[model samples]
Target: MQSIAIVLMGIVGMLIGWFVYSKFIANHIFKLDENFETPAHELNDGKDFVPTNKVVLWGHHFTSVAGAAPIVGPAIAVYWGWVPAVLWVVFGTILFAGVHDMGALWASARHKGKSMGALSESVIGKRSRALFMIVVFLVLLMVNAVFGVVIANSFVSQPDAVFPAWTAIAVALIIGQLIKRNFKLIPLCFIGILVLYASVFAGSYIPVALPETLFGLADTANWIIILFIYAAIASLLPVWMLLQPRDFINGMQLLVGLLLLYGAVFFSLPDITAPAFNSQTATETPSIIPLLFVTIACGAVSGFHGIVSSGTSSKQLNKETDARFVGYLGAVGEGSLALITIIAVSGVTLAASPEEWHAVYSHLGAGSVDAFIKGGANLIANGWGLPVEFASTILAVMVVLFAGTTMDSGVRLQRYIIQEWGDIYNLNVLKKGAVATLVAVGSCLLLAFGAGGSSGSGGMIIWPLFGSTNQILASLTLLVISVMLIKLKRPAIYTLVPMVFVLVMAFFAGVIKLKEYWLADNYLLVFLDAVVLIVSVLVMLEAAAVIKRFRRGD
Candidate 1:
């Protein structure tokens, strides 16, 4: 019953959040004008700016931002307890995330669909735009590297997922070709999904596990290299090709998988087994205040969500009113996924006896990525009587598959930022897609080697940085949106308060991380943390300057 209640609560909460956001925040506050022209229509290039179906665009937006964060965050942050994680995922999305996401979409549409980096120049100032661009570029670099690590690790952990995961690319390519050739939508969707599931099932019997080590590198590292090569190629392609279609298919898989878990829980109604709190092991657990805010970013509020909104989704929105659904409701979808994760992990862990529960969570990584795979798999298998090992492979494949989509998006966004930088400095080659892509992929490789090392241990070392930088990025994005709103003489406080709060929390978290890394002599992370903090502080200072001008009636 506990599991069922948790699932029900999350669904009801997200629906309510979706409704309130569309009605009060998006409709009343942003005053969404249905007839307003959008960038997708005005600049329909059929490549990057393809005017897409609202449903397809929502799937893309949701899956792109809906990658590993929501799954990983709650899985790990359950250290503080499932209750707090659940509360934050539910309320945080409603109050802060929905507004923040919609603000990005509305701001971008109103400003000709420029990314947050470009918007900084007009809304804040040119110098800060450069600063903001660097921040976004660095963050995306980490994003790509992290997803590479994630995909590689998924393959290393679950060999049965590999063949099916790779096969899905073919499915995406075929789907893209069909769409380009003007195939019927209904039949195509059915064919695509059918092919996708067939691949997953086939992959189970014909697992393609790589050797444990190759050329003196961990299998995970080797897999990371291969994944990046794919990302580099895929990222350079048109959105409608591999990126959109693959994401759409992955979104469907995710939807069906979650529904299966929900159905299982509703039927079985498992009891809560994990402790409601774990403060007794204070040394092992983190405090829930600033850490919780940083740790559980995507499920609640994330800066990257805004990036996806303003950078990609805004350009593809077919109508002005669609911004409400694309931005706010996409976030609500992410929140619901996070809530489901909390329930699955919490219930599964609680289902175990005390001795077994302790054994499961004994390791550092146990509560995080491992937990999501095992816990989520447990929920699905136990509920449906599926084989646990096979269902686990299915879930692992799902994670790696979405990780690919996100990495592709990250590299593409990085390319855009680099080209814009070239425009600022007048380097023609930089504007060239080939040159910009090389630079983007090259930077990703460097970051990958440093962050993951040969074995990818360094990836874990810098994991927390993702959450802090993510929230800080959200703060910076909100700052610009707030400035834009104030300039138009509308209510800016809707975005301002969350901006300030995120800025403070992320800034504090970064400082603490920097100190810890310095003391541990983890110079790489210490340097990374220093850059994140300095850039964020400068950006926040820029926000201050903008606010000052507004107060002076400028």
Candidate 2:
């Protein structure tokens, strides 16, 4: 029955969005403070502020903001069909990405941890934190050049998911040397999830490949310059060796690839054959009111999950009421992985046929990662008979371990915003951290070989300016967390009503994608969508002049 009513209405809208984020946004609007002092126990310094483990920092903040941009923006916004992309991924993850990721991990754990570009000038001021760290360094250089062309287009279109996504980087560098000697966490997370499912059954009998051109530039742009030279030496290590045990074995391989695609669609039900409101595929795609709010930014609302909720889950928050279970259950686990990628691309285009779902949605380009890995490998081969190239190599090793833990935490949040702009200008080689991880993986290898267009398709030439600069960085991180809830009076009308609907639908979807990249002239996505609509209209008129000078008292 319509594929068991799209997995029982997306698990009853993620259990009514974690019961309205634990009853009305965490006990009536962002209360949080369970004995406040946080920055991982007052800067624990075991490197990058330690104190984690709220379910391993909610599986490293939901696999570092669940990558593959919520399965390529709701599999190209299911051409505005699947019920307006599942009611904007279930009421935009219960009222705009769970209150802009629990008001950016409760305004960066109440400031000390600081990051939504250093609390956008400590709550809207000081030159608006250098224009909010140059719009968070052009949205982490278009999230490290579109997840370095989405893990080099899932390793040149799934060469058997490059040996179980490089065997979870040698089993997260041997569980970061058994968590640097102390090892014990439930048998090192059950032997690192049994060595990530025996490297996905030894990558189904060894399947790695490359060299179809190397220096002349092809083998998927030399596997995205060897995945940004292993994300510039794993972004200068020491997150307990290899980004916290390779994001705790890629967050148990993203909860064992979303429990085998929602337990094979609730035990093989598979029905909904696409159209739930196609309107002629939203009149040939693009424009489902501000390009479906900038093409379903991260399953619904993501100004880059408030930079992984204040750049790295509020610096590994341990308490202060674990910021509503790690920023509203890590945005309800990426709005239940964008509601299981809109019921696995509308029930795998109802088991494809309309000339293979019009050559994978005729309008929205780059056959949306081959129509979301052939409609989630024909809904896990109708729930059991596996082998659509082994269920598209287990959905291309869960899209290269969720875009390699989002380009390994977008190159450690672009090496802590290029070592905080080299301590605000002195520039002693961007204050070290291996020269800001070699200038953040050398500006993501010069924007992944200069915005790769062909074969490389540098993340599909900026996937619609990474969904309108990720919903204009979620409408300037909900106007800098509604000007830090009007400097703590605490009732900034719940982040000023989704920050005026994501600042007027991400500045009218970056002025209709800057007149469709200036009539296809495509001056680099018409100068990066007119510099993301002029630095999002000067960070929304500097957060409406700091909410009209904090209501006149300024």
Candidate 3:
């Protein structure tokens, strides 16, 4: 029954995404003027604005947006029956997330690839643009902070993951440099990924381990420093050698992950191990509503999509017509990837055995980071030919890589935002891109430091912020998208409907949390909760105001 419903949901999601949301993106919202050609085709800069094939672009787009959100969200959300959560995944993708992403692409494309900040100013108001930047800045701060902690936890908890990932990255860097310096060495990159995965399996069997001697220096702090160092180098390096090549090599990790997840589901067919409903789960839930929305945010919606849409993607658009297929359809496809992750994780855990499921959740620290690994260990021991520990280790390596790839992307975007902020605000103190890079790196470091604690366990402080901030950003994005939809003179209600829902759910959640914090004995969470709630509401109200004014034709 669950499988049938999920399959049905996927079909419905795909259909609505293709037909309903995509049409508006391609035809109405992003409709380019007949006189102007897209920069991708007209400018033809090989470095940034070069036109590429759709498939390649899709690959780039998918990797850029795909990360831990989809998998983590559904895994956690399954606490609310697969019915409610899956409904959100399917319906949100079709109506809310699909519209938000596609609309962001179209709006940005029409404006000649200006950023989300610039678009907010030109379309809405200058004040709103500044607010948007401030809001997004904070959101990125939370993102870097959370991901830093997540990676650290994965490594610290599962010591086996650290070597494989480090080795994989080192191998990838060498292969990338070879490919760039000697273009004929392309095949070696693929070979490196294979060798790296094989090494992970071998390490699992042999158990080459690291010392737990960093008693004072938390794992999160270590990750922050490591990520900063890597970012510093990555920022300074040529894209061809590091970023692009590594993405291509690391890209297979996602593919392998999907294949393994799918195989486990079909072969093992593990019963779901979580509860469908429980009040206790809500109180003890790691997810606050604002936080849950933020955490689960990518599959449903995100403002970051707007940044990508207008920044690089708009410039790379080959045809105005392709925006629908590329932008709208592309978002739907991205959502589908998230859906796949959710389905994969959810299938292994269910609503029946909350305690047992909690055990599985705790085992995330036990050399395996996902339900697939935990569930698969049992299944593989029962069904598959491979050893359970070996299979589990393979899954861990893939997850680490998946989380690590996003770190690079996050740094890159953070740098861009810092540079733009410096220019717009006229902060000469920030110097050129070099200083901006440092500032971005420094900011991420501070965020990492703030959450530094018992590696993964103590990092929970900032983890809640991701979902709250992410949802808040999504609301702001919906405002811009709604305004654009109105400007294009489509039925604004379509965009407005989902936009309103996200805002209401997030706002109410934020307010309730704020009250709880205020009434609590702990002033720290009270203060934090108050700030999170207030900022979130202000952003939502600001967006609503902009959309309202745009609608009134004022």
Give all TM-scores, in the order shown. Answer: 0.95, 0.35, 0.82
lDDT of each: 0.80, 0.76, 0.61
Q: List the residue pairs that clash in candidate 1.
A: 1-269, 273-350, 274-350, 303-474, 452-456
TM-score ranking, best first: 1, 3, 2
- What would the TM-score be for candidate 2 when compared with the true structure? 0.35
lDDT of 3 by residue, 385-440 (tens): 66777767776666666566666666666766787777777987664657877887
Greater TM-score among 2 and 3 belongs to: 3
Give the clashing pairs for model 2: 303-474
What residue runs in model 1 are displaced by over 4 Å at the alpha carbon?
213-217, 349-351, 362-365, 450-453, 456-461
Q: Whose lDDT is greatest here?
A: 1
Tens digit per residue, CA lDDT, model 2, 1-554? 57677667867876787775555766666778778888878877887777777777777777878777788788877766778888888888877887788778878888877788768887787777777677677777777777777777667766767887877788778877876788776688888788776777778788787978866878877888788888878867766677777776677666767777777887777777667876555354666887877777886788888887787778778887878877777777788877887787776433454446555666764346566777777777777667777777777787778778878888888888888888878798898988898888777676665555445555456566777777777878888877776777777777788878877887887888788789988898888778777877887788788888878988
Clashes (N, CA, C under 3 Å) per candidate:
5, 1, 10
Put the candidates in lDDT order, highest first: 1, 2, 3
Which residue segments of model 3 deviate by more than 4 Å?
Answer: 19-24, 32-52, 167-196, 202-211, 214-220, 236-239, 268-270, 273-295, 308-355, 358-372, 376-384, 450-460, 520-554
